[model samples]
Target: MDDFYSKQSPFNPDVKSFRFYKNGNLKIELKTKEDAEKVARLLLP
Candidate 1:
């Protein structure tokens, strides 16, 4: 399963900085820890 495909919650970006909240528009339930890491990597990449 090396070819993994992951997607982001659409409202993830609109989230306030330094504040954590669940995105209301995604089709999947993205955990806070997972979302934070994903968003961090996306921005830093």
Candidate 2:
């Protein structure tokens, strides 16, 4: 998942940072909530 995010990050300038929780959840921080939502849509099916 980290590698996937790294590869995809270049196409998403709005992404500020991303982390994977110990519980297996992904947390992505973006410039704005809308950007976060957009990233979520792209990352998810």
Candidate 3:
């Protein structure tokens, strides 16, 4: 998990990323409609 966050450079300015919650919730600040679709797919049961 640390390695993944490191790869994303969380300290960098304005980096788009998704956060997977422990309760299967995905948290992200979507910047485009395409991003929303991608997340929706992953969340589908």
Candidate 4:
């Protein structure tokens, strides 16, 4: 997850932080709900 964040964050400054859980859940913190939704869409398969 750290590698993914490091590579992706440079292109997205709005992404403030991220957490990956053992239960296969990822939590991403962005500047706004809209931005979060956009990132989620981009990350989803």
Candidate 5:
């Protein structure tokens, strides 16, 4: 298998950029280019 272990620097947070969500039951929107997909997959949903 290809080694796909990610590096810390490769997933650095965007200080000026961030995802936003109102409440737990509300809608959530993420920065388009911030690799939000990876983060989203980590959610319980």
Candidate 6:
């Protein structure tokens, strides 16, 4: 699942950078909240 995100997003060190839960929820830990939101929008349905 993490590997899928790494391939989709530009962010590196995917495991440390992003977290995806089983309920289709996304938690992104990064300096740029805006960037995280962008990725989240793309990811979420």
Q: Each model's TM-score?
A: 0.31, 0.48, 0.36, 0.46, 0.28, 0.34
**Model 5 misplacement above 4 A:** 1-24
Ordering by TM-score: 2, 4, 3, 6, 1, 5
lDDT of 6 by residue, 1-45 (tens): 343233234356533355556666666665666766876898899
Per-residue CA lDDT of model 5 for 1-25, tens digit only, reads 3233321222344322333233323
RMSD of each: 12.7, 6.6, 7.5, 6.2, 14.3, 7.5
Q: Is 1 or 5 the stronger prediction by lDDT?
A: 1
Model 5: weakest 10-residue lDDT segment is: 2-11
Candidate topping TM-score:
2
**Tens digit per residue, CA lDDT, model 1, 1-45:** 222244433565544333223443333344577676776798795
lDDT of 6 at 17: 53
The TM-score that candidate 4 achieves is 0.46
Off by over 4 Å in 2: 1-11, 40-45
List where candidate 1 sits over 4 angstroms from the true fold. 1-31
lDDT of 4 by residue, 1-45 (tens): 343423124336787767666566666678888987887799898
What residue pairs are clashing in model 1?
Answer: none
RMSD of 5: 14.3
Q: What local lDDT score does residue 38 receive in model 1, on the 0 to 100 scale?
A: 77
Work out candidate 3's RMSD over C-alphas.
Answer: 7.5
> lDDT at 15 for candidate 5?
26
Extract clashing residue pairs from model 2: none
At residue 42, give the lDDT of candidate 5: 80
